[model samples]
Target: MIYTGFMFIVVGIIVLFRKIYLELQNIKIIIKIFKQQFSSTYRNNVQIKKQKHLTDLSNFIPLRSYKVYTIDQTTSLERLYMLIEKAGKTTKFSFSTYHDDESNKNYFVIDFIQPSSSIIINVEISKISHVLNDKLQELLSIIFYSSNTIYTWNYLSFPPVDFLIYDHIYSMNTDKINPKNFISLQHQFKHWYNRTFKHDENCQQIVDFVDSDGPLCSCPYRPCKFPTDTWSLSMAIMYTFHEHLQLNENPLEQCLAITKLAIIIEEGRNRQRIEALRSPSIHT
Candidate 1:
């Protein structure tokens, strides 16, 4: 009787162990299935973002009939002023600077464009006389006083604009210049990108996929997730256009890039407005 009782107790223990082992195997299988689903969802989300970027590129509008002028000391300031005056309210300004190590002075390259006239002017005021600098300052003040909207990537941090604005602040009549006329394209891009893509479903998935507790994808290539921190101009360009823009201090190139980005962002906003109008929400 005692031997039989012992045998029964042993069998019961073995049975309990086997049940626990089977449950663990089932749990492993469940985890495998979950990982597969997660990976598929992540890939799908990335693909959606890529498609949107490609769509943006396809909608690009090329600048037409624009003439670029590199104006120096010898160039006619009168004609330049006339061109600027004719440019009217559709002018954009950008600037770059070159520091002379020997002279220890910063050289300014001021570039501006008139969309209506399709004229781009690049002026080198570094080598110009004090009289010429004053005239240039006057020209800039005129743009500020006028209804023309000036665009820059980051005017505060931008060397050319910074020096121009601060150095000649007294001369430019700071009170008359409406602060609203200047558009910082970098700030605009950040706002646009954050609204359009940064907080999207795909970005969230990217956060999840790279989580320590989550399984990593087996694929060799991992698409970069949108930044959660500070957004730089280079990052903005890379994500928006899917092309790497070489960083430089060239105001002409910067201006062109800024203009293009603004147009693209504006176009996107217009489309969104149209879509919202077309698709009204049904009230329950």
Candidate 2:
């Protein structure tokens, strides 16, 4: 009788394991179905929005032109506004009449990511296409360029503008970055820095300041190293933007970090010098 009872228990255990495996397979099928449905709905919604915006533009555009943008963080907006304000100050022909015209909107695209959403303004560029070139994608690209944000906020194209970027451009706190955001942010930062600041005057000065004993700030530190000309010292602050792995609010500390990067590059050059000196046969 004892042997019979043991045999029964073993059979029950085997049946339970089989049932568990079957249930897990069913769960996997269900999850796959849900993801497929979600993806379909998201694409459909985006298409509808694009169609609606395009329909609205058809009425206003003379040559059947359209413009769109997806903007992010506060700095991106600041850069946008800086251009718009300069346009306003310079008395851009379209700036004054964008709003007064019944059919136009002056400042479009003012969505925010997290903390900066609260401060976004709702101004439009109602008459930009009217006064400026009908094709704004090329011009907006130049004006809205900056390293702080990841994507382009200006498009001189029609709806379903897949090539155009329509995402938020927020400056992460730099201390604690979301892993997904950090990856894209790091990539965009490198691309923009290389393009924009490669020949910037302040960037050159910061390189000099670290090695040549230049002034620490506007006023000389009196005993400074890494010195260079102080023509556009203010731009050195932008170097901090690229130093994402290490960011501090204090501009002075950021300047120091910039100095350190210059130090690393300079050190590399010195090492090459030393190696060349030791090897008479090798022309570096």
Candidate 3:
């Protein structure tokens, strides 16, 4: 009976140790999250200052705002430019030929700065609704390699109206349309943002968040699941305004550039996973 009682005590001790270990792991995760958030905010504040400086420079001076990623020889600029062409004629988007000047890197900008009206347009829904699916699929193809993965990591708050509904609205009333009519669609997309972000209301915060660096939607949002595409299309729009029904001129170029950026990010994440596997002491 004494031996059985001693075994029970040993088991209780073992269980207590396991609980402590799990709690410690949880604390570590929380610490890491806070560190990342703080780091991001600091970088954003610096970028905002830089953006103000660049904005006073000139028009057509490619804003230093495109997302940058690390790429080696395998990710050659020539090869990437060719891929952009394969998607569509790269010239349509005014994609400069891949030059190894080292000063200028391969990138595409989507923002339009109207000096007269002082209106800066960042993200816009495509008026051509049919193309939305194809562009999104093309983007997903390079990032995930399969449409199947889209459902697994659903992060994009895509525009609500399909081509048919948009056409119906256009035919019914082109003159005077109320923005309030599309309230339902806005509500539907509220749940699609990353980590319980209130996309509809808080997404407006993105207006001031953009500058020469890139769109900073990190205000209330945790790291977005699809940061490559979603981060580039940082500012969003409701279908209420006529201006909302527009997209970048060379949609394919922007899509292709974002895909390349996605590749760099995934490769980094992949390396981290491999390193974690090698280091058994390192809790992932």
Candidate 4:
């Protein structure tokens, strides 16, 4: 009887141990799930905070109010000419272009800033026949000759060559167009650190402040190295404004971004000048 009682006790102990083991396993699974949930929540929170910070930073430079007019075959060049005439002859013009691969067409965009608002003119170039018949030459003359300042992103090869390419493709006469009048923003942005605007005979005229090519902003502890090549339009915009410039095939958007970048650069330079004037070192 004692042996049988001992056997019963052993069986009961084994069953109890098995139950305890299963409960411990259940607890471990619950803890693992909790840890995964906590990690996922933490990551989500971090992403949300990062997006909020970027949004707040973007507010530093407000977007300018501008109207975009897309001109195609249906639109009248006379109407566009009237608008251009109203902007006055001396108004500065920011120019950009786009080429659509799918449609096999070209786009020309012009942005003009006004006291009240800004205007963007986007011209669609479909065919050589349409380009010649639309009196586009007269419009080109008005834009090229009327504006004292013609701002292009890269005058060296990209946009400066655009005219020549167009001429080759359409056999358009570019004799009246003067190349010396075109100003390059890429050249300007690369040399933005010199404070004292200095240019040699070979250098194109910079619109506002001139600074040498180098990294402008960084932590004081560890300054960044100077860039080797000229900054592209998108890179310059991000550097100056702390904003991402979305690049696409839309010529109108490109013009707008270019114009805004120019404005921001001027404003930043003005602020720096004001700060310099107020500093004690200036009086010293």
Candidate 5:
């Protein structure tokens, strides 16, 4: 009987140690997976240049000049001359020229400056709708690649619409649409959160406690999941907007929101990192 009891105790010790060992191993595996995923988002160093030149042509005269220019002239000088002529006597203004040499397209920024205010127009070579759609797809692609790993890790039962939200943000900024629409979209996301986890008291409590400008506190019951794609999408949109608007609430606020959302998700899971590894799908 003594020998049997001793054997039972020994077995119990071994089982406990095994469980601890497995837990430690799981933690290590998770960390390793995260590092592998994180490195994939920025692995390729593609030297693509999307240059925008701000030209102060306030002193330049429109079509009255002796310079013979063609309507179809693709050269930078000819295009600049055409833009000046198109302004039609407007003075003291700023315009932008964009050259995407990779795509071989010319884009223009037509800004009219009155003494009191300024209005800028995004004049693309293509139709505005087409340009906006292309931008949205580009933004979505970035998010999709960035967050592919998180989707696999969680085995998400259904595809989340975070990518859509990302596209919306990019569309709003790149297409130069009214910012009120973006604000409305943000509110809509809050409403969706409310509906998705209405039954969970903890989630409801968290949602209720969220401040207007406070870091987004996701539903605790379902818990907000941060895939690498979500972060990439947010960053890409924020970075793109930062390039143009330089608005008071851009890039910084957007980046902060990303970081905060990640923390909230991580805290809810009692996990160290909120974002899963960058998706293998991302082209470095």
Candidate 6:
């Protein structure tokens, strides 16, 4: 009996130690993953900061300054107003116009007026697109819980008609816009903006056309001039539309895929603009 008890105690100790060891190994693996993620994030942040600093410095000392023409204020304002009016008919939303001191004097401002409990639309163009995507997802979740309509109250509203001309002038003068990729970039933006505001069946149809059928067949309008592709247009719509719907937290992989795609779109825009400026016409 004594020998048997001793044997049992020893086996119990062995089992406990094995269990502890496995738990410790799991903890170590988790720690390593966390460290790697932190390191990668830190490096990315450093690179972004450096790039922004360089851009700001370049603005001060112009090697080849490009001209940026202001948008036709009256026309831009009218277009924005019209868009809001169209969006308001289907959704319960309103618009209020506000003018900042600088914008009031310089540019037009149209506020997408909403209730106090309404979801506010905040676009952060400065941050990396990936970060912005995550932020947008979070914002949309919050908006979904609180309000039905998401309002993007513009701090500065420029007319849609003058968008191309203004971009051309800006690219030529300040080197801000890229002439070569300007058309594609604008198309991407138009699709993105439409996806954000248009959430109904018609919106989905447009999204499908732009994303899958190619740009030529994607635009529903009679004279669709913009380039729409299955990837860009559909992703934009999915990202924007999903915000208003109830979300599940389990499919983290799917969420990440969407976020990554958004980042890709943003990166493409940035690269295209820069490449356009490097073209022979700009050099001369």
- Candidate with maximal TM-score: 4
Q: Mind giving the per-residue lDDT tens digits that candidate 6 earns over 1-284?
A: 99999999999999999999999999999999999999999999999986764453211111122222122312244433444343343332211222235333222122222222222222212222343334333322332223333222221332333334323432212233222211223245455444333333443344534443323333332123334423333333233222111123211112222322333344443433433433434421
TM-score for each of the candidates:
0.52, 0.23, 0.20, 0.59, 0.19, 0.22
Candidates' RMSD to native: 10.6, 24.7, 23.0, 11.6, 22.2, 21.9
Worst 10 residues of 2 by lDDT: 91-100
Q: Predict model 3's lDDT versus the native.
A: 0.33
Off by over 4 Å in 4: 1-63, 87-90, 128-134, 157-159, 168-172, 193-224, 249-251, 264-268, 271-284
Comparing 1 and 5 by TM-score, which wins? 1
lDDT of each: 0.54, 0.32, 0.33, 0.61, 0.34, 0.35
lDDT of 5 by residue, 22-95 (tens): 99999999999998876664453222222222221111111111222222222344444444444433332222
Candidate 4, 178-281: lDDT as tens digits: 66667777776555533323333343332355333344433321122354665676655444455555555344666776676566455555434533433333
Model 2 Cα lDDT, one tens digit per residue, 1-284: 99999999999999999999999999999999999999999999999976764453211101112122322222254455554543332210110011224544223332121211111223333223322322233223322332222222122223212212221212112223222221122223233333333323443334532223333323221212233322222232223221122222321222232232232232343433433422324322
For model 2, the stretches where C-alpha displacement exceeds 4 angstroms are 61-284
- TM accuracy, model 2: 0.23
RMSD of 6: 21.9
Model 4, poorest ten-residue lDDT window?
A: 216-225
TM-score of 6: 0.22
Residue 233 of model 4, lDDT score: 69
Model 3, 1-284: lDDT tens digits are: 99999999999999999999999999999999999999999999889976764453221111123332222223444534444334332111111112223443332222111111111112222232443334433431332221121110122233323323433422322223222221221123223333223334444334443221125444423334333443322132111100111233433233333222232233343433433433324322
Give the per-residue Cα lDDT of candidate 5 at 207. Answer: 40
Model 1 lDDT per residue over 72-168, tens place: 5676667667755654544555444444455464444444554443456665534566565566666666666777666666765433354454455
Candidate with best lDDT: 4
